[model samples]
Target: MFYFFFESRGNQTDPVVIWLTGGPGCGSELALFYENGPFHITSNLSLSLNDFGWDKVSNIIFVDQPTGTGFSYSSDDRDIRSDEEGVSNDLYSFLQAFFKEHPQFVKNDFFITGESYAGHYIPALASRIHQANQKNEGIHINMKGFAIGNGLTNPAIQYKAYPDYALNAKLIQQADYDMLQQKVSFCEQATKPCGNQSNAKDSCDKAYNVCGEIFNDILAIAGDINYYDIRKQCEGLMCYDFSNVETFLNQDPVKKALGVGDIEYVSCSTTVYQAMSADWMRNLADGIPSLLDLGIKVLVYAGEYDLICNWLGNWRWVDELVWSGQKQYAAAKNGSFMVDGKDFGLQKGFGPLSFLKVYNAGHLVPMDQPKPSLEMISRWTKGLPL
Candidate 1:
């Protein structure tokens, strides 16, 4: 189960947004003191208030998912192994237990949102929440919808789009792009069948390895470019500068302040990573069409400049999803995403779903462009268009 909680400073009536960061291993703590949380770390390594935190418009929950992420730990190693089933099931249990303890929030409008691998977590977990709501099961959560940020939902379309993304970004020469282009069809073929839930683990794993190589080598030419953002030098997780966060978290005083006991905090857990990757190639896009059909609003927004889970690939998959309004959704033109009355991104919506291509952000939108990211989330969560 997940652990810890970070409540936002806002009106009690605000909708609750459960935020999950996508490392498959990275804990929510990354999102807590950084990203969309109420506070951010300063240059001197002290914390400062973020006026644009998502907490301004909604309450947020950032939990260490699986059994061993962040402060979440278990005596049994088996508890650490997290596949899609464990993530979705444990999150469902967590919500039930969470709402039980905090009964006042049970009926409040709830939204699930996250970035990166959370593309997998949000959809799978949202499906469970919706199903439970249908059965009028325990808690009867006021489940509204979910949003994913630069997530990995569909591999076939995404994998095929890599060469074009790199080429269009002008990262590679024409000859190199032409050479890489030949490999896409086969790679996409490998990814296409692997998304099926019925596919065997070995089969899916092999496909991910085969097709994922397309984007994996994007930086091979540049040699030092950040995979998260081709716009910057590779600077490690959190863009290297936030190494202080790891330092601060490891301190005795900070640990005690957060009620984290004797356990040492790691930004990411290898055990959780391995477990989540077992079926990493599984087609998460399978759940989207149905989830949308249930009247659950889905927001898939990607930062325009990201190399890993880039906006082009995210848009491709959304356009490819089959649903009741597929044709209409496909034909819809993008509307300017405004922040502070200024255009900041582009959004296209149909059938309770929308896709936004945020400008100049990367894999972590909040970290790169915090103000715009905050406005984007606040507006969208309130049923505002983009």
Candidate 2:
């Protein structure tokens, strides 16, 4: 694993947060430079301080993982992970080694966080650490909780919400929504088998293929709008471009400073993404109830404008979660999410679980609303209300 660690600019006692970007294969550098990292790339490729960087409130680590993603690579093909077990195990092993080398940060409260597909990664990794700690495994990590922003955690439930989200967002008409219901029903039926432990990889892959049509249908109807944020149109193949990130990292001076030398930076590995296709429809939410039972905090926040991995899906899964606090959480009314005395969103939380619907933002909340996102992290890590 290749990671960039930035210590807290506030207090040394601040929590340590490990951030993972989605794509199942996207490098964490996307978030590091474009979202919530300590710096942003300038037009001239110079580094400029991100005023609302998470490191201002806590120590943050950006990791490129699962091998062959970003700056990390492995000679063995077996190192590529297709499922949460393999993914979580690799991260768990990294944490043990990391804590051993830097014992000082081991005692600090640790947090797992990320966006997009990290919805799957964060919970699985948190569950891995929780189980290991209960069993008295190597290196008892002082884990606090986890947070996900616009992530696709429970694909079955999330996939089903596609048509409803489209309808509610005014992206589709009543007639189009009524038409999409068939696709939604098909996705739901196909995805059910994926939740079964005895299911074959072929079954999961089939489910992924079937359920993907729901989003495909939406995109076909919605035109060129960015799936990450419906409010924006894609510039090319991507809604937002970070070509400068590639250009900057490939520079000899930058490579030498980072000590990566001549190793090519693989921005997004198609090999790893294709390998993990079968794992896409599996419900990662199955492991969260156990972690919640152990009193591990969870925060699921979403940007309202995101079509894929929309707020509606995340809210549905979190609300329908079969946990001890499910009733209280369901009964709880949303409160204003204030930043500097202005309401930026709505928050619903009870006990160890929280859900936020950020206003006027998209899939990448920090990039869309930096100050509010930073305040969100500050409040979340401190166990304070939003």
Q: Model 1 — TM-score against the truth?
A: 0.95
lDDT of each: 0.81, 0.89
Instruction: Give the top-scoring candidate (TM-score).
Output: 2
RMSD of 2: 1.1
lDDT of 2: 0.89
> Where in model 2 is the C-alpha error above 4 Å?
196-199
Assess candidate 1 and give its lDDT: 0.81
lDDT, residue 300, model 1:
93
Compose the digit string of candidate 2's lDDT tens values, residues 277-369: 888888888888878877888999999999989999999999999999999999999899998889999999998899999999999999999
